[model samples]
Target: MHAITPYLLKSYKGRDTEKKESEHFDLSNIKGKDLLELLHKYMQSKSAHVYDFKEEKRVFKFSDIDFDIKRRTVSAFLVAGFYGVRSDIIDKSTGEIRFPKSESDAEVLRHYIQFTVPPGSTETIGLFHKSRGVGIKSLFDKLFKANFLLETQATLQITPYAHTGAVQEWAKGASVKSLKVKGFVPSSDITVNLARLGECNTEFTISPKIKKKGFKASFGPLSDFLTPEASSTQNEIITLLSNQGASVRTVAELNGARRTFEVGANSGGVVCDIPFAEGEDEVELKGGQPEFQSTQKWARSLTNDILKGVYGRRAFQI
Candidate 1:
């Protein structure tokens, strides 16, 4: 058998204190993949999921297996997913299937559990170590200053991104702050006409940045902005623009503050309705990402999609 990869392990305190410093353990003996595969095998057995595991003097326990990894002696959980996910995704025989077929199993495994490298109680990876977004302001403050903006200076040929319900299912495991895709319902003017601009599958890149505060009650996190696929950002942007006029670059800029507020009122972000706009009109400004979501789905990468140019939405770098 191939040697398994090592891991950086740590304990997860409760939710209220989640943001605090944590304690870590270096699992010097077991490889991460080996540990996870063992957990998967055990989870398959209803009774075996919860059990004790020991490494030298350190003791660990997976108490009621609904994603909870605890020290055999304490009640703490482990910091898993994302940073420690390679072990879960890659298997010697199965390749890179990150999630299980059963929704129930996948959810439990992804959420509360962790095949992870836990950080020490005193560790810090610097202050900005977090999912990028205008947090408190997104919910309470009316103003969301642009963190960084990427407007298309020229015509951006969009690529058709595809996803089955399964890939989306996996996203929930790794999804950061965004709500799932099912949370959204497409707006009437939010058309997906691949052939909007003469011929199919193309969009004009007009300047898409506004100076002032953009929205009123924006919902979902930055991750929610990426819908079923990438480019979901520009897709929604064009859909709104098509309602006003159908050009790529010229009218793309919402020059006056008056018109900017209107865009928010009239349209939705990559997926969800901008909810409502306090201002008059707006456009995608840069800086920290401001994501969009209608009902569900979360691929915040910068795609041609809309709203947040993040999650899995891919933006062309010019």
Candidate 2:
């Protein structure tokens, strides 16, 4: 499985009272208590946890949470609660869609979150599924509020650590002249002006059907182009290409020469590989079994990767 590894950084401040100003507390400054234990208690309570998005309530549950005292680490899987789904089958002869109700209609999905708490450290690494909706930070914000667990008034933020070697190398290029987009399907019309004003530019517009198969384009260096249009600037064009699972390969002008670079696929988060052991078979689960053991294992493996500095120092640190 492909995963993204980001950092989870926490800071706490005391509630403001009339007598004194609110006091800030770093993870290192907290006295004699493990913050992860707060998470454990909340999960153990088995309260119904749901996230409101787009005016619809989606259920979520902390399926598996494990803390290792000796290693100072926490690993957990948050699963989307089971929802009923009806399977649709296309009739080859009649070209009609048929819906069938069966026990297989029950479906669930899970996302991963894991982090390590080193002694006296304020920042730790985190791993998250690459879904653009309802991100890791939002999930944590809903879970941990000021006094959600009485006396645990802590604020947490998860920010993308984008300063990696790959990104730095991309930035070092003199100017970007070309890019390729992948893994994106247009939900609506998308228009990209491939050149600036006063230049012979191709205004590339795509429909949902046409964009299903991704495309690549090239032009002169952006520096040589004229003023950007009101609708789309050079930066805007690049940002549009980078979003929604699109990776970019650019032809760049560097040191009076041109070179190709792969970049920005991980600008949202660092890409990690979750490979299974050779010759190890996957186990399929039935009723009364954990639905997301693979996800749980992947989260634990990513936490171990953080301790090994597999993603580089600055790339995983907050």
Evaluated with TM-score, which candidate comes out highest?
2
List the RMSD of every prediction in angstroms. 21.8, 12.2
Work out how many backbone clashes candidate 1 has. Answer: 65
Q: Residue 151 lDDT in model 1?
A: 17
Predicted candidate 2 versus true structure: per-residue lDDT over 1-318, tens digit per residue: 233445655565665787576454555445545665655666555435643322223456665677666666666666653334456666767868865544334234555666666656666556665332333445555555543435454465555543232233324334665554545544432323322322231222222223334642335343322223435555466556667434544455545544333344343235322222212213223342323565455445445435444344443321
- Model 2 steric clash total: 0
Best by lDDT: 2
lDDT of 1 at 35: 28
lDDT of 2: 0.47
In model 2, what is the error at residue 29, expressed in angstroms?
A: 6.8
| lDDT by residue for model 1 (87-135), tens | 2435646576765443112112111122321222211110010122111
Give per-model TM-scores: 0.16, 0.48
Cα-lDDT of candidate 1: 0.23
